[model samples]
Target: MRDTVIYAHRGLNHAAPENTLAAFAAASRSGVTWIETDTDILADGTAVIMHDSRTDRTTNRSGSIYDLTTSDLDTIDAGSWFSGDFVGERVPTLRELVSFLGPHDLNLNLELKGNTQGRDRSIRLVETVLEELRRLRPGTRVLISSFSPLLLAEVHRRTDAYELAWLVDKGTIGEDWRSVMELCGATALHPSTAVVSNRCVVEEIRRAGFGVNVWTVNSVQEANKLVNWGCTGIITDIADQMVEAGRRR
Candidate 1:
């Protein structure tokens, strides 16, 4: 197997609170070189880390994360639902993330969450985040990705330095994949494991010179098999376990 990078999916989220300082700190301490996270804009235009539209599943509240201000979000217990020891965790902003990771040579695989309001909100939100990232750390090795092809394109167009990865799902390759990436000026591809189906596609994408990072793989056996198939990197919740699996053979 290649010496591919192992980035914690949402910052050791399977073990710690997802998108919180606790999660990121665990990933940093675990010796991970990079950590990936989902980002959304709150009501006060603060960029926060989270995967879903709402905090109900990961937090002790219901309704959309975007619907709340940063202070409002701080009030909700973000960690209790995961485990009692992790209770009272607050959602983290991109700035907080940069501060937490500044001491290490950690890369940020920031995912922009779209599918929001119809008011150019997605682009505006991304622009704000990009500005923050650029201001905090110039020439930072930040790789921004997104499931929305259009939004991904917008992010790439607006920024020239940040590496962009287009996240594609099953049955979306060739024209749709290349076209969107080309339009966005993306240098990488982040396809879901379900989409990359076999070794042929994996080799093909790599041979074509695009960075390939897969997502959310949990099982050791399944993860070991995927790495053997040759992805440039693996993003996993069970990171330490899967990385251990990769080393076993």
Candidate 2:
């Protein structure tokens, strides 16, 4: 049996609020080694851990993440929406996340959220994230990923310290994925489950020498299939379940 790595999507988001320390803790307790989360820049240049550009869905506040500062986030409850047990969870900064995971043996797959503010803002976000990583230099392995080719390219240009991955949805994946990956200096491809349904597609990508890591997978059967197809990583919300399934296989 292949040893496919299981990455807890948003830190075992199914068990706790997505992107919260609680979820990450839960994942750690479940024996997960890889965590996949999103990071975005705030108004005051702080890089925060979140999956959306807006705080409406995940927090008590309703505003763009770009318009909010660290102080503003202090008043926001990032966990209440998911469950009362996590009521006081605040949105964590990238630095905080790095510190939090420092003692653990977990690897991070940090997805850079696309900025709608413009190219300059995007560059700032990239630089801010890279700077944070450089400053802390956490013990855990880090892989920076983004759906934006421009963002990935910028990351590639600024630093070669961390690995880069290009994210693509099913319909957006084109025949030129290889060329784009090369241009962005990405060492891996994170594609949606839909894109990897065709076995040959997974084989082709692995043949090209880029690691294949599929995202948001929840089904054990599906994960088994992907692993059999030579997928290097499985990003899933149900980490404990997936880990057990892998053991059984």
Per-residue accuracy of model 2 over 37-138 as CA lDDT, tens digit each = 999899888999999999999999898898988888779999999998999898999988888786766788999998888888888899889888875544
Task: List per-candidate RMSD values in Å.
Answer: 2.1, 1.3
Identify the runs in model 1 with alpha carbons over 4 angstroms from their true place. 137-140, 171-175, 245-249
Per-residue CA lDDT of model 1 for 107-216, tens digit only, reads 78998887577556786688778877865455447888887777877776676877888877786655566666777777889888887789998888888778888876
* Clashes (candidate 2): 0
Candidate 2 TM-score versus the reference: 0.96
- Residue-pair clashes per candidate: 0, 0
> Scored by CA lDDT, what does every candidate get?
0.79, 0.89
Residue 181 local lDDT, model 1: 76
Q: What C-alpha root-mean-square deviation, in Å, does candidate 1 show against the real structure?
A: 2.1
